[model samples]
Target: MSNGNEAGDRLRVGSAPDSWGVWFPEDDQQTPWQRFLDEVSDAGYRWIELGPYGYLPTDPHRLRDELARRELTLSAGTCFTAFHRGDVWEQTWAHVRQVADLTSALGARHVVVIPEMWRDPASGEQLEDRSLGDGSWRALGTGIDRLAKALHEEYGVHLQFHPHADSHVDTQQHVERFLEMTDPELVTLCLDTGHISYCGGDNLELIRKYPDRIGYLHLKQVDPRVLAEVQEQDLPFGPAVRRGVMCEPPQGTPALEPIIEATRGLDADLFAIVEQDLYPCAPDVPLPIAKRTREFLNRCGAGAR
Candidate 1:
């Protein structure tokens, strides 16, 4: 984690190896995980983040072997439904612990948690009963604090909270509140550009406001027109995603200069993971998107930091 002023300040650019990497269901045409590794490697990526959905070996030895065979390093992985609307805390904790063990075995450190929605699954109604306020924040903070301590002491892993569209904590205000309530040392922010922008937030301002808490980054780009449509239609998260509002890196809509500038001097350990929520429609998206993002960042002298 070198500053921009440092002689060697190359911002390591990599692809998030989730659905965006292989296009999930459509990726079935190719061999499971090996083909993904091969394709990404061929596309010129030495590192990749694993999505929750993929052919990842639960066993450490096999996972390490697979990574070695592909010459790829595990940059990070998703902690699915960990904080999401599920009553599987004990189960999720075990699963996350296993992921932590896997990460340690593979020599990676960061785990991204996408919080669950406190909504009704039946009619897609927003649930107001279990909403978090001051008291709930205290309880949530306690839970996260305990979890963070366990992760640090047991596995030496860092927990990065990813605020996402439709999730409980997605907006800039929600992020700020979470940061204010939670233990900064235990829980850090995964500043996702597209999510923030989609929520009508100024990504640069948030980054500047909490530079130290930025644990990792999801370098996504959004289409301004699509964003406009989302707003005009007053579409919720599901419909918005279905309408192709969110997109790949190197935004075809809004300019990404501000984002690059915002992250220019960041010194904390960062994984600028190129995450394009799009996959099924655009199968061969991640490689080119990644290449373009890295080049753009490099041009902006983002690699200087």
Candidate 2:
């Protein structure tokens, strides 16, 4: 189940449930969990992330046995946070604790935290201001810092903040400001290539500017043609994803080879997990695409050689 890559670099390439088109804990449209595990392993990826908390087995023993039999490993878990929204600490922590408990139990040390999107991801309706004010900004910083500390102290996991499309921290400027505002020791960037590019951020530039804070990687690309249309229509992430904004590798923007190369220059080994957002895709669509994307990433020199 190894990527069978040349062993000269520190990049550990993996795929996630997103690449399998799983977005919710239970969904008729998404791939089934057992099939996802079987296909991901068969597709040649050795590592994976828990996309939604309940999408996989929360019972550590059962989940562990499942992954064990497949010869796959857990890299991290995904969680959504809205610290900018006042009075969300308890609610946020409650959610994160559940995710972290499962993440840590599976021996994964990273929790990828996505900021709550300003617009509803499902409905494309504006749910909050696209921009946060000074007060909200301070709250976001404070709340995230506090959460990072708790995740480390309590669950022994690090917080990898993911700047996402339509969220307050989606832009390059927003990411840099967030880096400046938070403590680097506790917080790091997940550096989701597709989302950053979707928000018009530069992947290589961010890597060069803050190499140390780059903790994890989501290796995916944006289809510029689709992106242009998405921008013109002002589509929300869900609709844009449905429209194929996140394209397969070797078919999109911010070429991944250079980005992977830049990450190699860092001091730590990073998980460059493939996460193409394919919500509501056909049941049979993900496996072949997953195989091709895995092959494409290997050609990009993702496997540390």
Candidate 3:
């Protein structure tokens, strides 16, 4: 994990269930939680996120035991939000509380907050406007600030806002606006390389410009050929993933070595979580890719310490 830095200064690398083709809490097509835990550990990763909340066990005690059994530590729990809709604080908090509680109870200090997609990721059905109005923008910023404050004050968890594809906050401009709208003290960016590249944003530029906002990392890459096809065909994220748009590292755009190097310069310890969107994949698919990706990250100076 050395690129001119001490062990403590290196980014903490981990993987999540998304790499194992999980997109739901309980799906017949998804990998079983127990096997996911086993395979992720077998792939040589020691940290993980609570993907889709219930995809892993919800009981803190049971989950803690399971992780301990495998020598795995919890990185963060992901929760979705739709603050731009306005006046949904209670509704939003109700959903976030469960994840925040479990995340806090497990001693994980971060909650990855994903903005709800404007279009349904599964069906590509339009759900809301792709663009936000002024009022909606204000609502989004205010809501996220309030949410972050609440999560921190109540659960002692930092909010790492994730800008997702097909969501209002997908592009560089949108992400910048998001950062400006919320309190810097309360909201930090979970700079997901795959989604950033998928939406045509520059990961390196974003990191260089907003080093302080770069709180977490999702190491992913997009296949230029498939990405070009997806964009030309106006394909939805679900179909794009199935088309192999998000490829394994070193086989896609935005070579991770430089990104890892840049984060090292930030001088703050960060979690570099490997995540590839392979939802609805064969159960046999993830482990091999995970192993290779872990090795790849190691070569990039981002492996486990």
Candidate 4:
């Protein structure tokens, strides 16, 4: 493994469409796709995620041409699933295989597979039944492994499991159990730093424990005050997100520097994707935030030594 600074040369810093407030369809103020491309490019980001698969061009050639025009390239996209719920194996595979096809065509090799929460985000349900039973665990693990392995063998796309807040697997215990059950060869990890903190999980501790299992990275920052409120009130993921639980890099809590420091000196390419959970912002808000985020990353560890 090379030193952190040496490895930094291969580490490409990219931003996601989440910064432009494109998480869900209900967004009151979604930025136009063309405007997003222009701002991200203007902010000096050469690499970016495809956001939701369809938010950008679905046609592979058109997608590639759009990216090329902006001097930008696509990274992995987020894939939401709930394989633990019922007999959705075939249903799930149809979606996974379809997305894998699009992603591979765009020269991306990773999909951030996250579990869909079972309960209402704003309801007072307390995000219940989040932990799966032994049988569900086995089923979920095997199903993900099968999909991941297939995606890898067939499309050369790695399915990285992302443990999210208010989902089936949220806490350290839940994530650790998941890593224990899933096959490492097929199923890997996409560590979202912000979500880790949002769930009260120790981010650095997790990385030290499972460095190689991490195939993707979502560089987000948690606001401690908002997190405290969320945890205290047992707020659901939906409301928490709308409340702006995540912020720009400098405004986030626990700090990302230590997390970046821990990744130093590894040979693997770090596709560090900046995903700030913003929503319904002014048209002009994201560009400046993106600029500041790029500046923060470059100052810490975005560039080569």
- Winning candidate number (TM-score): 3
Clashes of 4: 3
Specify the poorest-scoring 10-residue window by lDDT in model 4: 1-10
lDDT of 2 by residue, 15-123 (tens): 9999988878998988899999999999988999999999999999999999999999999999999999877999999999999999999999999999999888777
Q: Give the alpha carbon lDDT tens digit for every residue of 28-144 in model 4.
A: 468888889999999988888877767888789998999999999888867788777668888888877767888899898888898887766445365448578888888778778
For model 2, the local distance difference test gives 0.90
Q: What would the TM-scores of all predictions be?
A: 0.82, 0.96, 0.97, 0.92
Please give the lDDT score at residue 298 for candidate 2: 72
* lDDT of candidate 3 over 1-305, digit per residue (tens): 44453432578889999999998898898999999999999999988999998889899999999999999999999999998998899988998999999999999999999999988888888898889999999999999999999999999999999999999999999999889878988899999999999999999999888889889999999999999999999898998999999999889988888888888678567988999999879989999999999887877777575
Clashes of each: 3, 1, 0, 3
RMSD of each: 4.1, 2.5, 1.4, 2.8
Clashing pairs in 4: 3-265, 4-264, 4-265
Per-residue lDDT tens digits for candidate 1, residues 1-305, read 22242212434556655534343323453235665666666655566776763356667788778778777788776775533333446876887787787777788888887776554322336655435656555656566666777788898888888887766676788888888877887889888888888877777787788888888877777788888998787666655655677665455534465665566567764666667665343556555655666666556545522
Worst 10 residues of 2 by lDDT: 1-10
